[model samples]
Target: MTDTLIQTLDVALGERSYDIVIGPGLLGSLSQHIETVSPTARIAIITDETVYELHGQAIEQALAGRQTHIIIRPAGEAQKSLANLEDILDSLFRAGFDRSDLLIAFGGGVIGDLAGFAASIYKRGMPFIQVPTTLLSQVDSSVGGKTAINNQFGKNLIGAFYQPQKVVTDTDLLKTLPARQLKAGYAEVLKYGLLGDPAFFDALEAGLGQDILDLDEAALTKAIHVSCATKAKIVAQDEREGGVRALLNLGHTFGHALELEAGYDGDLLHGEAVSVGMEMAFRFAVEQGLCPVADADRVSAHLAATDMPRISDMTHLLHDPAALLKHMGQDKKNESGHLTLILPRKIGETFIEKRADREAVLRFLTQLRDEA
Candidate 1:
């Protein structure tokens, strides 16, 4: 018999109430959640090539006992594009999906964002569930109901505020994730700590490792629970990226710009960019005297231990520090011609700011030159 543990998080929206189910072998329970929201109807499960190869058949078999549509795309951030979104729509159309039919985002953050964005626009809106298969998606992207897609303008520039019917995260699926992906996801997991809750940071610092990667059931569940709960609390306060919701973009502005600079062709994953971005945010904070130098060093060391990128590496990516500032100025999180950069006062403590000067920003990026 397969063991399972399910967690139900109430996002606090009365009519739009959702649940986050976490378990050891919860994928098999996908049908149960579907039934909770849907009354034995047709559905489509959208995923990527990587996930499909690892989990497609099992998911299909579990749900094949009923009407189902399984849509697959090439795996990676590149697949979260208009072309793939179009293909997913075509597949849904071919499957005769209607307003009543459901769309299931059945992979990592990329698949969840793409599939959720498609669901948001299909016939205006439809109820879909976030079956996140990655640590990043489960903790941050999947639960917040902020569905978006990247365009030439920027990452997640074009999207919606559509919430999922539910989110089912299976820890068992994570067992197969590559180490790089695991660490990338770990970066987001650590964000919850770096964002709030110092003890969580201590826990991650103590136990997140290679041995823990394959499957430390206790650690994995706690990580998912805390990350989702953090997002859930923030989303409850600001579901539309208005107030504290912007805090969630802690490392994203620089992160997205780096992805665009690299052309988003899987050369650098989203989490990789954010890993470096967080490092930059801290460095910028220290250089601007916004926080203590020791705090900034601590942030970089923790990130390095996780094998994430750093500020010096970023200076190499963009030769012109002015250009990076320009890219950051264009971030969606910005307000009133000011950048909403989330800087760390110390690990386990971060807050959004609109007071840092542009010249100081240059000083920070320039500081990396000396380190490199």
Candidate 2:
């Protein structure tokens, strides 16, 4: 994982295939990467205020001789809205951007999702690239091409599966990330292990300190590389969450509900909500005798050890069980009006349960509320 030992993982979608470059000092090579896809194209950089402040000059210097238009907006989950998406599209139009121009998403998950969604609809789709600055975006959201914005009803209720031309993940950018943001991002890294690789989970548990929390070069590199590969394989097979892809939502069913309950405010980050929701999923699975109570406890202990939030931490900010259940019903993963959820059978193994009972979920939510 030396600065020079870069890794390139490809998402093989035949005609739409693209490479995800994982390494350090990649922003300087931005123009070189773009030239391969849209040569002679101007760049429209969409970033939040924070990322623009941190990497604006570096990006400018990288695309030094190229024509670039910068659009800086407010940062946070709340910023992912129809209004903001409209603003971004308006900005691109004002710059007279055409089909050949490139849209670069240069922030964390929110900015990436918003900008990519904008790129997807602007003039019937244009090329977009991801320069994910946060650990969460690098390992999960950015790699999957799941662009989205939030609505009054639910999280990601509006979005598109628009792939990016390239994904540049410079792990060095993570060094300046706040400890909470880093820990939040680790939740997604842990998801791969929880969903399909027990050995990977074991490795993470044993090396939680240096490998994960501390962002050790080799460890972090391996985590991002493997996570991207896992996602690429699943997306290649399922593309649009028809079947196997749903397993990736192991914690998201409960997580999205929590996000809606919080009103997409900073009070609960997407990853932290997923961490708590994963804990709830396992605990619920045990309640239904689908998984062992011991297994559920072990998963909770691991997340807790990483300083992640427990279900109780954010439960007080939410409503009653019925209201939360209503939110879960509106998730996009549902089919035929059934409440679908990705539940774990054990560590490194999970399944989709469309038969998940609403009453059962209500009971579980009530139990969690009481404990909280």
Best by lDDT: 2
* Residue 11's lDDT in candidate 2: 94
TM-score of each: 0.94, 0.98
Query: Relative to the unseen true structure, what is the C-alpha lDDT of residue 223 in candidate 1, on a scale of 0 to 100?
Result: 80
- Model 2 gets an lDDT of 0.88
Residue 247 local lDDT, model 2: 89
Candidate 1 lDDT, tens digit per residue, 71-108? 88888887767877888778887777888988889999
Give the Cα error of residue 277 in candidate 2, in Å.
Answer: 0.8
- Across residues 1-372, which tens digit of lDDT does each residue of candidate 2 receive? 355558999999888889999988888888888887788558999998889888889899989999999999988999989998999999999999997789999999999999999999999999999999999999999987788999989999899999999999988889888998998899899999999999888888887533668878778888999899999999999888889989888789888898888888798899998898898899999999999888898898887777787786875755488888999999999988999999999998899998799889999898777776
Model 1 compared with the native: what TM-score?
A: 0.94
lDDT of each: 0.79, 0.88
In order, what is each prediction's RMSD in angstroms? 1.9, 1.3
- Which ranges in model 1 have alpha carbons more than 4 Å from their true place? 1-4, 208-214, 312-315
Report the CA-based lDDT of candidate 1 relative to the real structure.
0.79
